[model samples]
Target: MRIRLARPEDSAALLRIYAQYIHSPVTFEYALPTEPEFAARIGRISETYPYLVCEENGGISGYAYAHRQAEREAYQWNAELSVYLDAAAASRGRGTRLYRMLLDILPLQGVRSAYALVTLPNAASERLHASLGFRTMGVQSEAGFKAGAWHDVAWFVKDIAPHDAAPRPLLPVSRLDADVLRRILDTRG
Candidate 1:
């Protein structure tokens, strides 16, 4: 199997893997809205980096990607990421491989920190992230309402790089020199 960057053409396969979570009994009962505006969202986020997949036998079996942590300038360099594998593709190491590739790329992209919030206590995911050096940031006690009840969320985090790395500039950001801004904005390049 090989790990590679996801292309715009890969969105359909990415969505397929994502849909499994959206439909799973564990996930759906306390269902959260996914990309309701996929078109607009895809148009924007597909332009970023660390959006990747693991492919084998000529098909994508798993995927991982990062996006803006929030809309605030202070959140730059801190990304929110997700990773998923096709249930049929589990136990074959696709999820671990995909996440490794993403973590390897994130710091190079100036990502100082990365975070994940999981509704269920996924031992595999927790183990995988822990292997990649993430730590238990904290959990939100009974923080989410899914299906018909309350659920807890665990937030895991990793410092991808030293805090000494310069902060990413603000949007409409004059903070970065033109060259620096060019690199961050042109992730796919």
Candidate 2:
């Protein structure tokens, strides 16, 4: 298996993996985005954040990414992470590998804190986050309504970098040194 930076062209395969969670409480998205829409999302997100995909046997097995946790300027140092795997890839450690890489890369982008929201009853996702050193902050009961019922979401957080009194401005993923970025992606756990 290999983890690499995602390109817009990989959207179709990534979208296929993401669609699996649309109907389930694993994700809050209620609709499957079109290939073009997903491709555009890749382009927009890659501009400032790390967008990664894990491929195995010449196919994308899973994917993970981090985005701004909130819009305000003070929240720039915080990011929210998401990961999705094809049904066949579950329980195979692909999600862990993908998240590990993402956690490694985020600090380089000036991200100090990484967060994740796991919908209730997803034991696998909860285990994954906990295993990665993320502590549960709290749960928002009935945070979302989907699939004919209400779902609760648990918030998990981990400090990826030290919180300094004065932090240097965030560096976009695009500005990271090419060699360093490549090395991070090539390094496997």
Candidate 3:
């Protein structure tokens, strides 16, 4: 498996992986985004954060990304993460590997905290987050209504960097040292 930065052109393939979850509680989104919309999302988020894809056997098997947790200036150092894998890729450790790379990259971008929201009863996702050192902060009861029922969301957080009193300004993913970013993407588990 190889991990790399995602590109706008990858929208179709990535969407294929994401579409599988639209009918389930795995994600709160009710519809699959159009290719252009999805590509725009990749472009916008990649401007300041990490958006990555995992390629296995020449096909995209999964993806993961981080975006601002909140728009407030004070929240610049915090980010929310999401990961999705092709059905064929589940249970093979690809999600863990993709998230590991994402977690590793965030600190370099000056992200202090990484948060994730997992819909209730998603044992696999909950286990994945816990194994990565995220603690369950709380649960939002009936956070969203989908698939004809209400589903709760569990909030998980992990400190990716030291919370200094005066933290340095965030370094956009585009500004990270190429050599350093390359090394992170090339790392193997």
Candidate with the greatest lDDT versus the true structure: 3
- Candidate 2 local lDDT, residue 88: 100
Report clash pairs, candidate 2.
none
Per-residue C-alpha lDDT of model 3 across residues 1-189, encoded as one tens digit per residue: 889999999999999999999999999899999999999999999999999999989899999999999999999999999999999999899989889988999999899999999999998999999999999999999999999999999999999999989998889999999999999999843
The reply for model 1, stretches above 4 Å from the true place, is 25-40, 165-189
**Each prediction's TM-score against the native?**
0.77, 0.98, 0.98
lDDT string for model 1 (1-189, tens) is 666556666767776777777744335333433444443454466565456667778988887778888777777778888878988888666766666555556676677788887776677777777887888898888876665667777888988877774665523222225464344434422
Q: Name model 3 segments beyond 4 Å from true.
A: none
lDDT of 3 at 24: 97
The window of 10 residues in a row where model 3 has the poorest summed lDDT is 180-189
Q: Give the Å error, residue 62, model 3.
A: 0.2
Angstrom error of the Cα, residue 1, model 2: value is 0.9
Per-residue error for 186 in candidate 1, Å, reads: 20
- Model 3 C-alpha lDDT versus the unseen true structure: 0.94
C-alpha lDDT (0 to 100) for residue 44 of candidate 3: 98
Query: Candidate 2 has what TM-score?
Result: 0.98
Candidate 1 colliding pairs, count: 4
Between candidates 1 and 2, the lDDT winner: 2
